[model samples]
Target: MKTFYKYAAFAAASLAGLCACSSDDDAAETGSGLQAVAQPQIIVSDLTTSGFTLRWEAVDDAGSYVYTFDGGSETPTTDCRLEFNSLERQKEYVVAVKACPRDPAEYTESPFTYIHVLTDDLEQLPQPKITLGSAYASKTVISWTEVPEAELYEFSVDGGEAATTRNRTVILSKLDKGRTYSFSVRAMTSDATRFTNSEAAQLSFVTSDADVPPLVIAPTTIISDAVAFDIYASSDETYYYEILPATTFAKYSPEELMTAFQTYIVEYAKKQGISLQLAMASMLKSGTQSLQMTGLTPELSYVIFAFGMDLRGNITSNLSSTQFKTTADGYSAGPNYGGSDWFTQRFYISNAYLAMTGYGWTNSVWTHWKGDDVTDVRYRTLTTKLFNQVFPDPYDRQAVAAFLKDPNYGLQFNPALLSATVNSADGYNGLTEGVSAGTSYTLLTLATSSSGAETVCVNSVTTKTSTEAAAWFAAAA
Candidate 1:
């Protein structure tokens, strides 16, 4: 039995090879004498919602027929018949059929016979309920409940091309910010031939708008040893406060600075004499004396803060930090100096006199200045940074005469500011030789201007070690 099967397989292979060669000869006769087969007559029947059957009359010498519906599967049938099932409902299709020769070597195919047919329509589908979801600055999400018998859904926006998805939710992106838009969705059957739309299900929504900030100004004037300035406001918006060295101020993130500023406003308002409401309102409005800040160091760079409030009470337009440098004697000249170096000279004597007023000249304080008042009667050495105000040359002597004549001229040397010490009994911590190595320093004094503003003065000086103190004083030797 095995030997017989083997012999049969050999014969089949040889016959196939011969048929291939004969077909090649027929192709060679293509311009010579080859004839075409006749087109077949097709009959359609057994039409159903899912599929249909097709039949064709047998042609002479034909071995099989090739049939297809709407360019679908090419079916081979020796009995001149074919059927297609599991198709879409309510859809039109064209069926085409052709005949092939019975001879194994024949390669020619007959011209196709075309016919039209329609699958039975199905019941109209029910529309799905569409809804709008999250809306952002430039995008939004849409969703719908799954519809019965739905294989897919069509989502559309602004009458644009539809996108098909099996998902119940879809995100629409690239929308214009702060603009209104419309979106809709519809359900379709498995074949997509039966579809229904819910016109009432359309949704309209607006995207969120971008943030825009308001204008604000920072502090610029220095009025005392502890630098003070007025912050102006325009409206009843809560203004935040921020203070940081100019060097590192820019490094702070916007959100971080905002948080810190809130803390500053709360803490600062706690120390004011007015009610919280008034303090906050004053900060929100400008030109009131309520916003004067003091107790800052001199010769330092600082960045001040201001910003507008939003309807939600959140910080907005938060990029409002103005940079300013405090006025220090010798470091910077103030309006009162009149370009006279006497202002600088007066700053030192006046500043030291006020700071040392209540404290007597003890061994420690005397040694710090490197001079004993009784022994070194004519002079004292003040070692400090240079704080020199530019002075008019001819009037330098006259400015000196004016400064000595003032009633408060010797007040710093007196202990008058404190009740424990009296100028009549304690006398004065007299004299000063001069500065050794000088730089700028802002001098805060007990003196007040005529308008009641604290007097802020600037001057430059040279600081000296006790070892170098002898060279500054006339009586040190």
Candidate 2:
């Protein structure tokens, strides 16, 4: 079986050689028992930029044949068809196919077949150039340069469906305000071929008018560490503030004034939160007397000012009188009083005496009462005597308690009263060294000073008001 198979393969090889030699037209002279004729013919049926397929009529008794393709050396094809890969774009390719019969007895030369494949010439359209025009009101217009081979131009705004048109420009209307729009254009060929989109041209426009002025609400006065006035404003427009130093009067626009007032009130409120309102009220009521109101809760400083404005747009500046602060309830000694200690001591003694003789007193001789002694006749007599001597009345104890809780009472002497002097070198020079009449005192002294000569002369002495002085003194004690 192996020998027979080898013989069959040898016969097939001989027939294939005969077919190749026969196509060269000199097989008969070579004495190889084969006749040479023309190369097998190949007709190209389909051609593209990538490859081409060649088909030809089959030869009789042909086992296989070889053919040349696209100027390449001859290559064999067993099926009488040749496919040339890697063809150039828009170029022509020459192709041929040969066949050989497998039966040696029937093998003969067959005519050569020839075919040429030509790739179609495709002209790519140039990129379209887009130009976005300015937008007005509710409309925006866009224009673009036309592409030479473009069958249709495509236009789109912000990735929306593209509008097809042959014209170089298109107008889009009914755009929303404050919305941004992007325009793009592309060119397409007649055969449904599309080129890359052109460089996108973009222009953004906002549809808001800047002609309106912001609205201003009424002004408000914040009585605090500093007299701050607040004004409220409302509008779509942006606003800024201008702080007026002394009064609500301002040359700035209403918006500016409102902003300034608002800022002042906020700051003043923060400073006055810890201060006693009574103290502030008293200072203001001093009526132009240079009263130094100081020793306030350092965190909360009081301010003296008149009226403020309400939301009604009416200015209440003159309508409401300026408010002042008085001493706290526990420290309510009159301004002339130095400090609360004198008053507090008196109250304390009075309260102690009342407690001894009040309704709950057990003995009059001040001796401790034993278990059964509470009902003894001697204990009862002593209790009555003590009650009459000490309490005498319940009102006295109530008054003392009330005095202790007075808001005007301060632990320290009011620094506001003492005249302030920046320098205090000499004991007496007819001029106090440091004295300030404002809420706080500062001492000042000229440089000239000697030990015993009294060269340290003080001038411009200021003192705290009576109310402030009393408050400071009480608080210090």
Candidate 3:
């Protein structure tokens, strides 16, 4: 008969050359006093980035067992299972196990059977120290302390496309006084084995203050999937604009929207190391400058927001906006982001799993979650590749994706999921880093009870490009 003692692979990773216990090792009958014990079949369970549980078949004559990790010292255990904990992530380990007979004088110890596996990666890089070196109406200079292993620096201004430099100091020029500029710098290395891109060293600085500049931003062209707008600064001025669906525009009050936009401006400016005064002075036009947007859904109404900068480089209170509808009908309207009302319930689920009360993210998607409000439960975040593989159809919110509901299968496919799992119910707050611009990620709740089902709440965000995010995070904000 085929043995039912099955050990899961990484959802069954190919182990063509790896060794396993032979059929002779599975015999149940005990041999003579001089006979040797046989190796046991090993089963892996609860595998996580930092730890895993291992179990072995119990031999008829075995009273205890010995196990060792890598070249570490052997430990004795009477049970058929042993667990490894607090191990390093993304590293491989060798587990060797052998059985000891109930009567050691009568039976010889069994030969060791081993399993080799690599842990998952869910670690984050430390943030570097960045400061505002100098601030002027024309430009701002920012420098970050060197990271020990960093080979280069990547920084962005006003949430713009990231730029790389080997030098510690970067100059951001083009001055408009009044509004705040945000700068974000990160340390990076070519070697991913030891490090990842660091969390941004973020700082916000305001250029010198000056008088107000008159500016108006209005859409000049509106097509089915694209739109173009004109930023009328009178001469040349600094401002930011974003587009939003009409429904999203209604969820927040005017004050809330203002605060949100202001936050975006500062966060973005800090990345680039330039103030609006500087950006506008150089990037803005002598008269009106036109910016074009494409890849929008046709026939949908969008609100265009124009945020002004004061002499202090702060967001102005008197924001201006206009509404426009696309001219043609070609593309489909994608999901509207922000607010819980837009959350996609992917499956039928009972409150059997741990869930987060709320999650917040930066423009760069640096995310943190407060623990589940009700009871303590475990949860994990998935990579974009695995997350999309699980949900192929974006429109199918009423899904019956059973594989993900199975804890073993879910963890196998998303090996890194458990690396970020939170054990606490009400007091845990953790930040999951390694987010980049224009990327999508999924978060999942793990089932806690045997009788309960898991929940997959995906909040898909289609962020604008660096060019646009640098201008603003969201129009509704």
Query: Judged by lDDT, which candidate is best?
Result: 3
Winner on lDDT between 1 and 3 is: 3
**Which of the predicted structures, 1 or 2, would earn the higher TM-score when compared with the native?**
1
Q: Model 2 segments beyond 4 Å from truth?
A: 1-41, 123-477
- The digit string of per-residue lDDT tens for model 3 on 346-409 reads 2111112122532223222332332222222333455444455566764343442354455654
When 1 and 2 are scored with lDDT, the better candidate is 1
lDDT of 2 by residue, 295-337 (tens): 2222232323223333322233321112222332111111111
lDDT of 1 by residue, 219-252 (tens): 3234222323334444554455546778778787
A best-first ranking of the candidates according to their lDDT comes to 3, 1, 2
Ranked candidates, highest TM-score first: 3, 1, 2
Model 1 scores a C-alpha lDDT of 0.46
Global lDDT of each model?
0.46, 0.35, 0.53
Which residue runs of candidate 3 sit more than 4 Å off their true CA positions? 1-33, 121-477
